[model samples]
Target: MAGVGLALRDGGDGGAPLFAAFAGAGAGLALAFSPTLTRAPATVRPEDAADASGLLATVTQLGRLIGVAAFGTLFLNRLESLGASGAYTSAEALLAGMDALALTAVAGAVSGLVRRRR
Candidate 1:
């Protein structure tokens, strides 16, 4: 759904496609959070469950911080290099950042699947 919305973003439909894409992505992330939080601690012994949960939370937060920082840097760099053409440059920067993020996500997913298979 998110992918469909993203692919339709260039249709010039008054931002509806982008909004739907973001909404779907947000919903997907929200849905995954609970199961991930629950499952992380379940892998530990009873006494270590609390510690595992805490570690999972800490790592999740740190990853978010790093991802945001990296994406911000990429966007800013692209925006600057594009010579400040206003909305067009900004859009290009955003697209570049999103593309990088999507690639990173696909690579991570692939690596995770490979590791699980091994």
Candidate 2:
């Protein structure tokens, strides 16, 4: 992740795309389970605590989704506008990493969800 940021700053050899995809996928998978994990009743049921925790988890998930979208968009836009030179373009590497994370996350989430259902 840190490498991605640096590469973006220094303009690497088109490695950012891979990083972004991984980041996006990770973000998606991590967030997708938010609701289910939140709503699940503990064997020992912590009552009010469990409910609060679930709410917190949901809120965090929302934030994660927002971040994922933002990063994904930034990466794609940067990639498309490779001809342009600016801070935005410089950010492409990090954004790419983030996108990759979120993309992976989404795929993992869908798979996990399906598996859980079965």
Candidate 3:
């Protein structure tokens, strides 16, 4: 749903669609985060639970950092290059960034599903 909303964005519509997309993504993450954190420790022995939890937290934070860095780089590069051309606006660059992030999210989800199946 979030992916669909992001992909559909054309940089001309009102804020409602963007808001909905963000809301949907937030809600989905909120729903998935708790169970994932809970389950991570459960897969380990009692004494190892803390280590598992710590590892999970570390990985999660690292993933977020990498994602933010990638997104920022992509967005800023697009903004600078396109803005220089005078043919595209910041909004268009923003939309491009959002679309790239959405595609990345979709790919991650699919890969996770495949890993789980295997």
Candidate 4:
């Protein structure tokens, strides 16, 4: 999912971007069920389960928004900084920004794993 999203471009030969979109869609579908599935076994009462699932969905959406805003700000700052370099095209700046975004995702995944281990 992250891989496919990171691979997207403004335009190019072949249907690579289309393929990436499908991949992203697949990822989204997988993620969509996660909160409900996680709550299925974790919560005891049905009412509590419903509440927890709702809360989970809300938090997940909030997290998504925050991540987008933070990463977008970072990307724009990076692109602005690279603007002065004549050799760097907009496409190149976008790709660089995406690379940085991907790194942050990797960092988040790593931290999640570390936290789980404790």
Candidate 5:
């Protein structure tokens, strides 16, 4: 009974909904960037098997935050260009887009590192 209580409070089934959302996002990103995030199922941590959905959820959420900060900064940077316009420009937008792509690549690298040893 004590164990059950611990499980419920410590991110057991109670956290299912949050994890589900994470997995949905993760699946989308994983599929979109399979070339980077792809790995053997066996490589995933044993704990991940219990909630493949949740682990993905957590990662996806954090990734989104990291991505937003990186890409947003790239887009909003004040710069002088376009004939001394000294204002927001398409160059920043383009850089932001590429930063997001690079972020995805880094996510894949993280997944590889987190992957369990066989």
Candidate 6:
């Protein structure tokens, strides 16, 4: 779901409606997984389930915050660089940044799969 959203954002051609749909799809997918993923650790460690769940949620939020902050900074810097040369617009920079993040995510997914196989 997020993969699809990222793909759309990376090549959305500045379409607001398409981005909105992508966001909706991604949100739905995350909502579908939240319960199961959040509950699994609890099942394994009942005594500390509450703490574990809280930690999981905290880490998840932190990961999102960090990803956005880091990528946003990168996007702004790239935008500025391109603007200085009169070579690119804000939309282009946004797409470029999204593409960068999408590629990184793909790499991370591949590495995770490889590690699991080993």
Q: What overall lDDT goes with each candidate model?
A: 0.71, 0.62, 0.77, 0.64, 0.53, 0.69
| Worst ten in a row by lDDT for model 1 | 1-10
- For 5-87, candidate 2 gives per-residue lDDT tens digits of 54455555648565774575467556655655655544435667767776767887897898778767776676667636543
RMSD of 6: 4.4
Across residues 15-84, which tens digit of lDDT does each residue of candidate 4 receive?
A: 6665875677577557655754574548567668768767777887998899788777866776677677
- For model 3, give the RMSD to the true fold: 2.7
Could you tell me how far off, in angstroms, the CA of residue 18 lies in candidate 5 after the best superposition?
36
Q: Tell me how many residue pairs clash in candidate 3.
A: 0
lDDT of 1 by residue, 1-118 (tens): 3253345435354366667777776876677577767766777998987788788889999999999999899989997987565545455666677788777766866886898798
TM-score of 2: 0.38
Q: Which of 1 and 4 is ahead in lDDT?
A: 1
Q: Write the per-residue lDDT of candidate 5 for residues 1-118, one digit (tens) a residue.
A: 1222222333235365546644555765566666434543346787776576566667868988987787566545522343267454554444445445556666766786787443
Q: Could you say which candidate leads in lDDT? A: 3
Candidate 5: regions farther than 4 A off: 1-48, 78-88, 96-118
TM-score of each: 0.77, 0.38, 0.82, 0.60, 0.39, 0.68
Clashing pairs in 4: none
Better of 1 and 3 by TM-score: 3
Name the lDDT value of residue 50 in candidate 6: 78
Alpha-carbon runs more than 4 Å astray in model 4:
1-41, 111-118
Better of 1 and 5 by lDDT: 1
| lDDT for predicted candidate 2 compared with the true structure | 0.62
When 2 and 4 are scored with TM-score, the better candidate is 4
Clashes of each: 0, 29, 0, 0, 1, 0
Regions more than 4 Å wrong, model 1:
1-14, 84-88
What's model 4's lDDT at 97?
A: 57
